[model samples]
Target: MDPLQAAVLQQFFEYPFEIDQTYQQGLAGILANNPSNTVLLNTRVFYFNRLTGSSITVADVLAYKEQSASASESVPPSNSAANDSKEQPNVLTFAQLQELIESGRLDEIPNNKTISGELNSAPPSQSAVSVRRKPWETSNDSSNIMES
Candidate 1:
């Protein structure tokens, strides 16, 4: 597909594109060498799911955005701050980390040295469950299985 068509279709669909490190590095090098040229790269594209197969208008999207903004605003500031502090660690691949950095969400990058380590650090430990139970198998004592 032509770049123009891809640009147009980006508004409605999340199409696959070259996001590999080598391609990005090459693009960056080209841009660095030619500062006069304007490069428009779409790193992320969001498309709403059509569960009901219903047509969606721009107004619908706008209304949904407005509603979400208002809802977030209704959340208490203290609660928001708490949420930020207690944010769960995100396990991300190198490519994903690069994408986050490029998208300007550096804070989302996990800094938990205990969970993950630097490139030179040892590999992450494997997680093993203390108890392994089959889905079809049940405990002999069924008293606590159904509680009021």
Candidate 2:
């Protein structure tokens, strides 16, 4: 399977897509230097029951198929596409991925906003981010600090 360029990888991260049968499916390999253990399926992870490790290969995929088939006794072959989207980790070599991926996926990681997050309270530490006053505090020190 030919690897998708970084541009395509960025697009893939933004949206759920199907790999053209004529081409290949390797969303993970393109982004990360190697395939991570987790393959995100619509913002969730799909763990291969039989194959658990840092990377997945063609052989492992085949084994996964076999396992799924065997699990259901007396069931006929699946004729329809799976209801869930299937996005496998792209298994690119470190050099290949580094060359392709100019930027990192820090932007892609999800951030959750807590309703009642902790406020900045001063404790003794190497403090660069010093607040002269709490939000509710009347300004004396803050005025002086900001004036300086």
Per-residue CA lDDT of candidate 1, range 1-148, in tens?
3455334434433322233344444444444434321131221121222322334445444454355457678766577456533422234666887898899887786542334555756878888857788786677666456542
TM-scores of all candidate predictions against the true structure: 0.18, 0.22
Clashing pairs in 2: 28-90, 29-90
Model 1 lDDT, full chain set: 0.45
In the range 1-148, model 2's lDDT, one tens digit per residue, is: 2133333333333333444331223344333443432333312212221222223344444455465568766555544223332344334455644655456643332221336778768876787987676676766877788779
Off by over 4 Å in 2: 1-56, 67-71, 74-83, 86-111, 115-119, 126-148
User: What is the TM-score of candidate 1?
Assistant: 0.18
- Our tally of clashes for model 1 stands at 0
Model 1 misplacement above 4 A: 1-48, 57-59, 67-73, 76-91, 95-148
Give lDDT per model, in order: 0.45, 0.41
